[model samples]
Target: MPAQPDLRSSEPQRGGLSATQQALDAQTALLPYALAVFTVSLPAYVWAGSHAPNAVWMSATFAIFAAAWAAFYGAVNWLKKPEAATDLKMRGRVQIFCALIWALAVGQIAFFADGAGAAREPLLLTAVAAAVVVIFFASPWLPSLLIVGPAAAAGPLIALFAQPETRELASLSWGAIALSMALALIFNRVLRRQFEMAAERETLIADRAGMVEAARRLAQSKSDLVATLSHEIRNGLTGVAHVLAAAAGRNGRGAPSREQLSAALDAANDLISVLNTTLDSETAEAGRLSVEARPFDAVNLLRDLVLLNRPNATAKGLELALHVSDDLASAKTGAALADAHRARQILANLIGNAVKFTVRGRVEARIEQTLSGRIAIEIADTGPGLAAEEMERAFEPFLRVERTSAGTSGAGLGLSLSRQLARLMGGDLTAHSAVGVGSCFRLELPYDPEATAEREVVQAEVSTTPDPADRKALRVLIAEDDGLNAAMLRAVLEQLGHHVVHAVDGRRAFELAKAIEFDLIMIDGRMPNMDGPQTIAAIRALTGHGGQPPIIAVIGGDAEEAMDCTAAGADAVLRKPVSVGAVARAVADAISAGRSEPENRVVA
Candidate 1:
């Protein structure tokens, strides 16, 4: 026969009660029914004792049975408390203990009734009924039933079988008791299965609801992001278009004033800043954001950011000030070994936000070296500040403060991306704000004195070299799929005095490279018909002087993509939104490096 599942089993189970917990619940339900049986049994015992030969002993036995039932009831009530409810082992032991007591008390009563012979049949029937009730309740947990069931039934059978006339009656009673216990076991199994099913159903419902809620939240977040981007982009482009139209005399204006030009530049820069921040946030989330740590002049970078932000501040009628600590002022160099690009990005965001929000009073930028030899920059503004709750969520991506007016435009990624960059560079960014009292943001970075001296020495050595502008004009090849981008690059190269050859794709650029030995090659990282890296690799595989020219990869991705371009034999990597000066310098550097290498050799 297959082994019966142990009703006493207590191994943990998910989405439903464990075996022990089920057993505890069974015992708890049985308590009230057991109490009623004991209450009625007391009166029957007293009446039987009055008509018995050993009446005094029977009465005393009845009193002890009452006391045991009282103790059992107390234990069950105690288990209802929060602390004691989970003690499954203790609860099981208590049920076993009570079962033993019940068996002894009822068995003795049945024996005494059979001996009295006055109310013999009636009392024996009552004892059997009481035992059957307990067996029904205790069946859910087999340990209790195993001891109590047989013992409760055995006492009456023995008493009746002792008399020759009652033996037939006892045989019939035995069959009924066996049938009752069987039914109880079957009922317990069916009920427990139902309970488990209910528990599982509840769990499934909860999980589905949670998934729906998460999907709803994500959809709402994306909608808000789209709305913010559209608003900011439209406003910025409108300002730039208006200024340019005026400058061209198309709007009946002779020439653009200095203020108009500055406003236009600021508007265009704002659009770029918003786009970069959005890209950085996505890159960071994908774990592809790279930090290139190097030594740079922190003091100079902060001064430039403050100077750039002053025009915006003055236009808003807000005072802007830059403060340097005595130590930093005397040293004249706040050198930090970190990601210079990301540091500039963080400080610019902080300063820009300070100026943009402060309608009156002043915006201040403070630079200092902490006692632990770390560089610290704090941007404070006298703006309509944020409340405690709003400040807490300031660094959350895509979160815009409700205090921002309709005129103020942003994509809500500046603070979030800035903080991520700070931590990536082995530093931190923090903020302090109070409603109506203004706000302050602090950025901290690692400092290195040796890097400062090294930078200064390199600067002095470079000062003695010939200017890149004095170099002779050279042939430059430009590979870009976008027409406007190619035109802009061609214009910049021509203005720099280099003869430029334009290719709409990498295939054309490769063909041009094979036919003509160019002094430099600038290719886009991504293009149709042949990507930048693939073209560069193919060019490098060519024979003779076809592959020897210096190659520069123009990318619009994070540092990981830049590394990919360089791996394919490119000499340098330049990111998109390139300026005239940046292009001129890249051209000069590539040409200078190419001249130093052998003609028939390829760079790898």
Candidate 2:
């Protein structure tokens, strides 16, 4: 059996009871004392009035007992005060005071009964009973026991011993005293146990409440995760649909030119990037995302972002402008240590949003170095700007701001992911906007010129010749399970002037590949009968005539897929929502690499 947790440890040591319980305890503790005063005072006043050495002594004794009762009443009132309720010391003092007053009343009764002889027995018995009641009520309090215990035991003896004929009553009085003391100890134990049990119960209740609150938060987090995934996946599907429709010439429009098809492909790729960024944000929230800092030129990065979005701005009849500080432009090295990819992602999101939301006016990007050697990039747009209240909420995932212009709306993860990426790189993204004006997003990143080092530059030969419209077409094989994706792939390949053969599953594709000699084979990562990696392995193991055709694995935009495809003997990997340009590049690169190797030979 598992060991149980000690709940007593969780209970507060001082005043742990709720207000109602404390009030009840206070009343119970004071009740017995009040009753004892009444029980003893009435008899004392009668005795003094009937049998007194003098009227003056009788009046004085009666007056003293009355005053003691009044003082006890005042102490009870003091304990009842709201300020005194939580004061443990004050409560202890009040209990002690009550005990003392009780002791005094018992002592006084014994004094008056001493001279009354046999008549004093009833008075002494009454005093003993009152002491027992007070001790019983006060047992819950430790201080009360310390003061009242001895007084209760000794009060009866005062009257018994003071009598000259206490010989017969002495034994009986001692037994009563012993019995009262025993009851006090027993009741004290019981009361202490009660308090401990109550405290334990309170502790368990508090723990249960905490667990409930935690469970609620976890459920809410799960809900948010589902919402984010649904929104982003829908956006990705929309991008895929737009690109495919354009490739198939099904938009009730003329055939899309190569540039338009390329733009659509770029849009699809951007959607994939957004999904990857969302994953990055999740990793960041879990504290697992790490930054890869290296030396990079900030000027070149900003220039690229401006150029990339310039088309979008122009298409919308909006001016795109860039302003770079002279100092930054003229810096000898112009290098900064940062995560260049993440920085680009943040800027892309900001610039993309600016272009998407704006209609007629210009979008301007400004770059400069701060006094503290930090780089600040600001993108200002004349879009229907965000309202003041919408500014902060804009960064919350799945929260989309309503715009006046009927432009495309997103999953609202872009800004949130961008801000998280910026902060992870030891930078921050902030925004300033007004209702009718415009919005400006500022990105601030640490810039360390002192740590800047010389970076190696590699240049590639540029090709200015236009692509030929009548290149040699090759036989291409495609294995995909998704119907829409297969159709899209076929459309792209045919548009590239290639003869295409489609297989619904990898098993059929492998069989067809063995029968026919094809120039290229494309396999989807997830397909019926066999996955892309398994199919690649099977194809590589096959005995072929003209060597195995160059194989390309089409997969989701994930690092794991790329690694798996490479490990499985694929020549190249293409991320899905495949475009004509990507397919052409993959084929050209694979065939070029194949030409350098012997025919009918697997490299591995």
Give the TM-score of each candidate.
0.67, 0.54
Name the regions of candidate 1 deviating beyond 4 angstroms: 1-200, 247-255, 282-344, 358-384, 396-399, 402-406, 420-428, 443-472, 558-560, 581-604
What lDDT score belongs to each candidate, Candidate 1 first? 0.76, 0.70
The sequence of per-residue lDDT tens digits that candidate 1 reaches over residues 158-237 is: 88778888778777777778888898778777766765665566556666777788778768767766777788899999
Q: What lDDT score goes with residue 492 in model 1?
A: 73
At residue 419, give the lDDT of candidate 2.
86
Estimate the lDDT of model 2: 0.70
- Give the count of colliding residue pairs in each prediction: 0, 1
Candidate 1, RMSD to the unseen true structure: 8.0
lDDT of 1 at 553: 85
Question: lDDT score, residue 564, model 2?
Answer: 78
